[model samples]
Target: MRWWQCRLAAAVALLAAVLALGAAGPRSPAPLRFAPGGRFKLALFADLHYGENAWTDWGPAQDDASDRVMAAVLDAENPDFVVYLGDLVTANNVPVANASLYWDRAISPARRRGVPWSTVFGNHDDMPFEWPPEWFSPAGVPPVHCPPAASAMPEPDPGCIFRGTPRVELMTAELDRACGLSRSSVGPRELWPGVSNYVLQVLSHEKPHDPALLMYFLDSGGGSYPEVVSCAQVTWFHSQSRFLNPDGRIPELVFWHVPSTAYVKVAPKATSEVRKPCVGSLNEEDVAPQVAEWGMMDALAHRPSVKAIFVGHNHGLDWCCPYEKLWLCFARHTGHGGYGDWPRGARIVEVAEKKHFSVNSWIRMENGSTHSHVTLSSARFS
Candidate 1:
């Protein structure tokens, strides 16, 4: 067999092993429980752009850095839960099936450390092959097996450059298999439009049904679609929040890959416009118009229970600024695959088991320095 065939075979064998292990019934993750004093620490790892130069030394080395960051954070914080804020891998250079390897490696640190974690999709997570097939041809012509009409279909044709299973599907499957207790068995039923929109409840006490905090994970519709949090998703969020808390009183923190448009206005000067103390680099980029504001911002503003929004798209910017009645924040880019040579780190948010349901958050670098500690809540922001 040829080199690509060999790689594919190896990847397939590895994937089969993973599936078998998942089927063999590994112990489900225990429910998230806080330490004494009703305090739970959660770590946010972002932009772990694994697979920069797949099947090469540099790419694997970059992933090693991500592993080190995760291991270091897990050791230091002993967090109750962990959240990977997307851009989990740069799979453009690898086969779609082998993409799961990167995901597997990215979450290994957390899994080994015995921490329950979740993920959100970033823009680059499900990208197509880096170079079109024609680039490899002596004649520079795309394969003509599929007709032009195939391009208009919802799924890419086998002959198309973008043809392959999306990395997001593999992601959700792996997460559910590895950390069953952290996610719902039903997997975001018809109520949510996207794959990753699900919730993890932090109980006020040991009772599984009594929820004190609700952690939401959203896909942000990146990769195949425009990177926007859809209106349907916003409605679903409202409905879920109400179903969970009929009195509309539970505290929530939302996590996703891309930031909403509000970040642009709040940090036009690379720093917060408000009087709040924001930290880390403000180096912001032009917000993608497709992803800019839909009604998600409005929904968040109107829902006073959502204490803050945490994201990880723009690797350069890491600030927690006030946008309307919510705190718009970015996770410090933790992977070395993408751009930026700034000191790498992860964001940490702590929720105390208190009556007020306030949150204390900050950033912790690989070297162990911390900054940008802040408290957020609708009452405080309002």
Candidate 2:
């Protein structure tokens, strides 16, 4: 064939392959938007903690429990968009070169349901593994039975490497999935090392021409780096919000894995019971916040458009309290692998299509129980 014909043929083959991938998977909806009834529902799954203790029977059982939790919440809420609010895997406990396998499993529920989703990194997401004393002691390590590896191995042998996967690799792999609706992205190169510092818009159902809401996902650094939102993120927020919502009329919400110091400030007293104005079921532990406050909260507080912020680091706390001009909320523990005896559940956020509407949130537990309903008005924020 001629050079031009050859190039055209190659392009056709590539398109065909892509189409095949899409056809092989579940059908997906259009880019995120409110339903025809002018309402958007979002479900937040936090601290899934997959890939923990793969060598033990109990570990896989816990992962199975986590899967059931996700499946139940997804079916119960049927969120238009889902956010894997981080700690999707206990990287330190994961004895593999790539934690993406667990990450993929964590997101599988949404993918199977054809729901769009996003993710942010948590401290446990990229933590390096610490050698267990038991492995070096009398207890022999279980030989990795994963195909190609020897059925039996010595104690000193490095059967698996758990150095942790980079944020870039995970993000790129998710984006490259077949017909996936993953909105996750590694933001500007300036924020290198901090992936998922991007913004998303939820379009209006009735007026498709305009955006109904603005959502910002930032990398609240953790694991390999200090648990704090860098100054660069604050600057990026101002720049992006200014350019996106010039007049600051559109309502905005923020999502990150680790809770900012502002959460501590707004947190209900550790000993006090959760009440109205503030709403949630569990308050068993104190606020496990970021390392320090680096002006991100100040920037958000100053922005009249920012209505609320969502975080998921403390599995035992799942409350939302008014902070400055916006609300600070924590998603419920949605995994069996984390450090909590609390029941698994997910936080649900719903917004109306109107420019001015109320933002309502509640927790949907695995056993079909829903509680801790709270509302934030867009007009009040405006």
Candidate 3:
């Protein structure tokens, strides 16, 4: 039998064993790889805004709808990995002390299916609590409750209500969960206040040992801090790329929540005919960028190996347009919580395990319809 056939059989048998055992909880992640046919699929669940208004039926209902969307996508695509592409919860709206509870629910579908996953923080993930205006009204619930879970808050809101879970604590909780496949990291100390900055390697289906792809996650700051990828983060990226891919051979893809100013640079004008080269159905809002661009884009632009940057801030936009050497793409809004009545869905990325790989992405709607396909590669442009 051929080597690929052997790998396929092994993967199938392992999956069968896992099904027999049942997904009581996370099983250990086998080594990450594309399917034996040299294809790998990744599902991106973005702007879930999971914990919004937990006290209200509307909030929980939205979460349930989001859960259905994810379950549908997972069943349809059967991705190799999953990425919670930011805004896991609207922390300002989340009354709970530990927001990780909501964050955990956001990635639960992938966990049950035994797919490895990771996350990056969005502006809402750790925003300080904003009291409901109704609380100050005559018919309001008294604003006397203090969060029992949040501790050592560096800065608190007016009432000393829970400041949302800091990035460190959120990422740390996932690491502690023993979820087995949560590749989320708190990132480097030098880049403090910017947790969720880390990298993950997806091994080649052929070599099985060598990393064929490098996926980098950066903390594009928001919430309490300005929504900017700091110069320090750029420096860190330079160091990591130098050490990991000095030759710029392996392909790299980046993930964060907010778009950099570079996105605004390439965005198709919001008003006019709104046609492609940029292929997306919706363009509801202008690019909501970080407060500043302090060199992260330049660094990625200079690197030929950097194929694309995936982000999730704009629920209205889900298109991949070229930005210098790479593509700037917005993941489709996956949660019903965010400000969109449009169809809920996840963005799926597929990569080929070839010497010169092409990364393709499309939006898979909750109704099981897929659209907006684009290839993020120089060859496509050529």
lDDT agreement with native, every candidate:
0.72, 0.85, 0.85
Q: Report the alpha-carbon TM-score of model 1 versus the true structure.
A: 0.79
Candidate 2 stretches greater than 4 Å from native = 1-29, 144-159, 378-382
Candidate number achieving the greatest TM-score relative to the actual structure: 2
Where model 3 places Cα greater than 4 Å from the true spot, the runs are 1-30, 142-161, 271-274, 380-382
Candidate 1's residue-wise lDDT over 1-382, tens digit each? 9999999999999999999999998675666665657788899999998867654567668878878887877788788888988888785655434455577678778877667778777777777767746567796743332223311447754433333336446555566547453342223556333567878878875444577788888878676667888877877888888888768677888988888787777764643332444444545554332355668788878877788899888877777888767788888888888887888888999998666667888888888878777786546552
lDDT of 2 by residue, 1-382 (tens): 8999999999999999999998898655366788998898999999999978777787789999999999999998889999989899988888876777788889989999999998998988888876667787776676543222222344555547656777787777677672557988889999977888999998888878788899999998887888889999999999999999999877898999889888887778885798866878788888988888889999998888888999999988999888767889999999999797889999999998565576899999999999998886534432
Candidate 1 — number of clashing residue pairs? Answer: 0
lDDT of 1 at 320: 82
Q: Which residue pairs show collisions in model 3?
A: 221-227
Q: Model 1: residues >4 Å from true position, as ranges?
A: 1-29, 132-164, 176-193, 206-209, 271-277, 281-292
C-alpha positional error of residue 132 in candidate 1 after TM-score superposition, expressed in Å: 7.6
Q: Against the hidden true structure, what lDDT does model 2 obtain?
A: 0.85
Q: How close is candidate 3 to the true structure, as a TM-score?
A: 0.87
lDDT of 3 at 223: 86
